[model samples]
Target: MSSQPYRLYYDRMTSAFVPHVMLEEMGVDYELVHIDTGVDAHETEEFRAINPNMLIPTLGLPDGRTFGENGAQLVMLGDLHPESGMVPRIGDEDRPAFLQWLFAIATTGHTTIRRYSYPEEYSTRYDAQDSVSEAAYRQLTRFYSVLDGVISGEPWFLPRGFGPLDIYTILILIPFEGDALADILDTRPSLARLHAATHARPTVERLWNFYFGADA
Candidate 1:
């Protein structure tokens, strides 16, 4: 592959930020094209041609092929460039746990938050939706707590470094602003250390400013 064989179509804000963060960590050069997701720009025919789903973080390969789903992207990126150190290669023993924790963020962490943010879409009864959202919040809290425990107990989830596990999991949760998540992690010095290190990394810091900037 050339230095940058793919272009990352993404929005600086929203869920796309996660992969944006990951791609920066990958250490490989990439062509980055940022777009506003909910705006008409991303909905234009040109953009839709790449991702009919109209989602951000759609990765386009060199051969005019493209794919979505951030989880799948992480796995593929891992296999294609293990030296990036952002993920474990396919046959690595850590792959299972790496995938498990990454998926947990999608199935458990993000799913729980969904109920809170869009209760009405998921339920007909407004009252029922409230209860569901509440339950989801509690579950999310617990899951973050579990992650806190895991990170607290180790230097890294993989016993290696911040690969796909941290990339897929932590980035999803960071979008939650004004939460006690950081406070809870503070209780776990080890986890806090890891989080701090992640934030301190050059790539992550660049992404933080690029993706989270007020102008972004």
Candidate 2:
């Protein structure tokens, strides 16, 4: 391991939470650099130098390299800390399922949540925002249902146990907690069980308090 700690640029409640939990779970030394998205800190030229895409959850490595995107970061971290078992090794029975769920949650699930959360980004018309959000929400529900059915293991997505797929799934779901989440959980008991189990972890509980407050 490098002598310097990894640096994570984040904004509260963003996709940054995924890697935040992963880093904590891995027990690696890392520093949190908060970028206030409310003030558009992520859009500034200075921040762009770190990550051209201006996306949060940008990770700075000890070797002076930085990268963004939650899915890519999760893969890198898992490879770096194979002992954590966040990613299954080649030829492992769970490896195929692991890759499938990881990308499914990261791309399809993440995109749907993003569309629902920020509908204005999908459309410029003020009157159309609600429609965009509603459409996204409906799609998200279907996606979640599919995931709920695929989960055949106890407390985790795969038979091998807890890994990045659970973290990615829950991170996207967190934003819906006080809103329409209960409705989603009401129908998908499997997903609800996974949510509860993920949050029940000591690391997850502590990080939840830090990012969403103790009451959250």
Candidate 3:
């Protein structure tokens, strides 16, 4: 690894939270570059030069390569710092299940949440927004059901113990609020346990307060 610290472009409560937690867990030297999404900082040309996608959780590697996408960032960081044990090694039997959950969360889980949170982005018809959100909620519920069933480990998603998978899963769940969050947790015992376990970490608690405020 390069001696230079990794740079993480972040915005509070975004997918950046996953990598933020991962970096802390790895105990790697890193710098945080705050991108205030409230002001559209991520849309600026300056930020775009580093990440063409104009996304948060853009990682600036020690070698100067910058890329967006939190899932890829987690994979890269895990592979780069195997000593952290954040991911199962390529030949490890656990590696397959780890990748399965990681990619599922990154693609399906993330996409479904986006639809639920911002139905307008999926359609221009104002009247259609409710239906879109409702459909997304149904899909999300189903997704959580499947996720809840496969958690064979105690207080974590995999038997190997806490790692990137737990971080990524909790990231998707954080956006849910009020009855929505309650509904998910109340119905899924495993997911509720996982959520509690992830939040119980000191790193996660501190970062959550840092991003969403102590009262949150």
Candidate 4:
């Protein structure tokens, strides 16, 4: 129950999914403001004033403060609502490893997904876009493999149970699934199971429907 009014600026079907789900799970009062990336809404001065980087998932607080970057935002939310147990307490056994994977998925998987999705943004050479995308997909698969290896099949990333880190894993994995990448996910049993479990969560399903229509 934060006294500050919160707003999430996001694009449809984007990386903002994670924080959206997190906010729903936390049951906080907030507003969802959609921006059309295709129309360069992110690059506009008004939006840039909220987030200099013009990134989706820029969180606005009542005090006129804004926060961006998915990793920092997730950690902040978890810290703010310790009763939710989305993050471990300082002396908890899983705290160290939880933090490690949180950053791992954020830095490695998130970055690779961005490259795979928009190679043209990362590469100036039009001819190299295909090669860059291919390499990024390969790297993304490898990052998934790393995650698969770590799962002990307990339905959550950490031994303690569900946490914010699991949400991070789901966000990073969502873009790479349900098409040609299905085979890649099928090969990793643990990760696949983890994905299934994460997606089945009530909060995720509710938010998915909200953000992408009921048909989604």
Candidate 5:
């Protein structure tokens, strides 16, 4: 057993759900430190100790090293425990494709969701004469269409089989689901298939129910 028992500092519910599900899937003994994110508890000193950027999902290892950011953390977990089989390390051949879609989801997909979901931030930006909500919807729809065209019934983001990429992609959508999710999925059947597969998995369902039963 590894001495690096994982510790998660995250919101009660958020994209942290992704790695939370991944750890459960890995069946690793871990500890969680719930900070009730967005209450600005995440902005405090104690929380900042783990992640200077004040990000959630920071994992502290037994070696005294800590990590933050969902993408980097999952990739590191995959590296530390090969049995987890979630991602490639510095030298692994799977790195390229895994990293590619990782960036795609985080940047092209996740950011757009957040940008639109919070119209207050973009409402005054000069980028649009249209309503901030409309621009956000348009950006989200474009990405959803792209996702629909790409993913198939395959379990993974790439053809490499289910791993961190798929986990993160599905988890990124947690903040923006419900009727909007259905609408987005309607535009892209592929994403709906991918979402269904991820949510249907027993491990994912367990975490989803626990994290998002009422909130999501």
Candidate 6:
């Protein structure tokens, strides 16, 4: 960890979840700037000034630089702590696969989730919103299935054991709460097992309790 404190603009269960968990796992001291997107906090000029794109999960590093985009953050963190296992060492055989999966989640899975959660962003037609959401759901299901098949017999996303990519992937499933989430997990046995295992970790469980209560 650097002498200066790293700052993160975050909201519970949002894309911020990944870096939040990763920071804890890395045992680094950081500050959380909780953004209440529910009240359009992210749209305010203050927030927009920090992140021109007005996205949550924006990060300000100790070096006095800030960045948006989850995939970029992951790579930046991994580069900072190469020995931390957040990513494969550069030029390693697993490096390509790790980058591939990371980008896939960021591009395909993350976008579909955004569409599913906020269909109005995709279209102004009130009646067509349901169709947009439904299409997003279908795409999300396929993404989950692809991940399930890849991690069929493994305990982690990569053969090298748990890393930042696992944290990112697990956070991808956090929004699918309640029975809808359960039903989807049931169909993907391997993913269900992974979710359960990750959920049991101390840091993850602690965050769950803090954000969603003990029962959650």
lDDT of 4 by residue, 119-209 (tens): 9999999999999989998898888899999976378887777666777787776565457658877888887777788879988867766
Task: Arrange candidates, best TM-score first.
Answer: 3, 2, 6, 4, 5, 1
Whole-model Cα lDDT per candidate?
0.70, 0.86, 0.88, 0.81, 0.73, 0.82
Q: Clash pairs of candidate 2? A: none
Tens-digit lDDT track of model 1 for 86-202: 676678776677787778877787667667677887898877988877877778767877876665225566687776565555564563665466665666666566666677767
lDDT of 2 by residue, 1-216 (tens): 568999999877677888999999898899999999989999999999999999998999877799998888988888887888878877778878888888899888999888998898999899999999899888888999999999966778887777788888787786586647898889998888888999899988787777777543
**Candidates' RMSD to native:** 2.7, 1.9, 1.5, 2.2, 2.9, 2.3
lDDT of 3 by residue, 1-216 (tens): 578999999887677888889999999999999898889999999999999999887999999899988778989999999988879989998999988989999898998999988999999999999999899888988989999999877779999899988888887786687896898899899989999999999998898787777543
Identify the superior model by lDDT, candidate 5 or candidate 6: 6
Q: Give the best candidate by TM-score.
A: 3
lDDT of 4 at 38: 78
Estimate the overall C-alpha local distance difference test score of candidate 2: 0.86
lDDT of 5 by residue, 1-216 (tens): 457677877676667887787788888878888877667888889877878988777887757677787777777777777877667666777677677777788877777767766766666766563577677677767776776676643644666567776777676566566896787777776677778887789988887777778754
On residues 53-144, what C-alpha lDDT tens digit does candidate 6 reach at each position? 99989999988788899988888887887868767888988888888889999999888888998999999899999999999999999999
TM-score of 6: 0.90
How much is the lDDT of residue 154 in candidate 3?
78
Clashes found in each candidate (C-alpha, N, C closer than 3 A): 0, 0, 0, 0, 0, 0
Higher-scoring candidate on lDDT, 1 or 2 = 2
TM-score of each: 0.83, 0.92, 0.95, 0.89, 0.84, 0.90
Give the lDDT of residue 58 in candidate 5. Answer: 81
**Ten-residue stretch with the least lDDT total in model 1:** 149-158
lDDT score of residue 76 within candidate 6: 84
Q: Model 6, stretches more than 4 Å misplaced?
A: 212-216
- Name the regions of candidate 4 deviating beyond 4 angstroms: 212-216
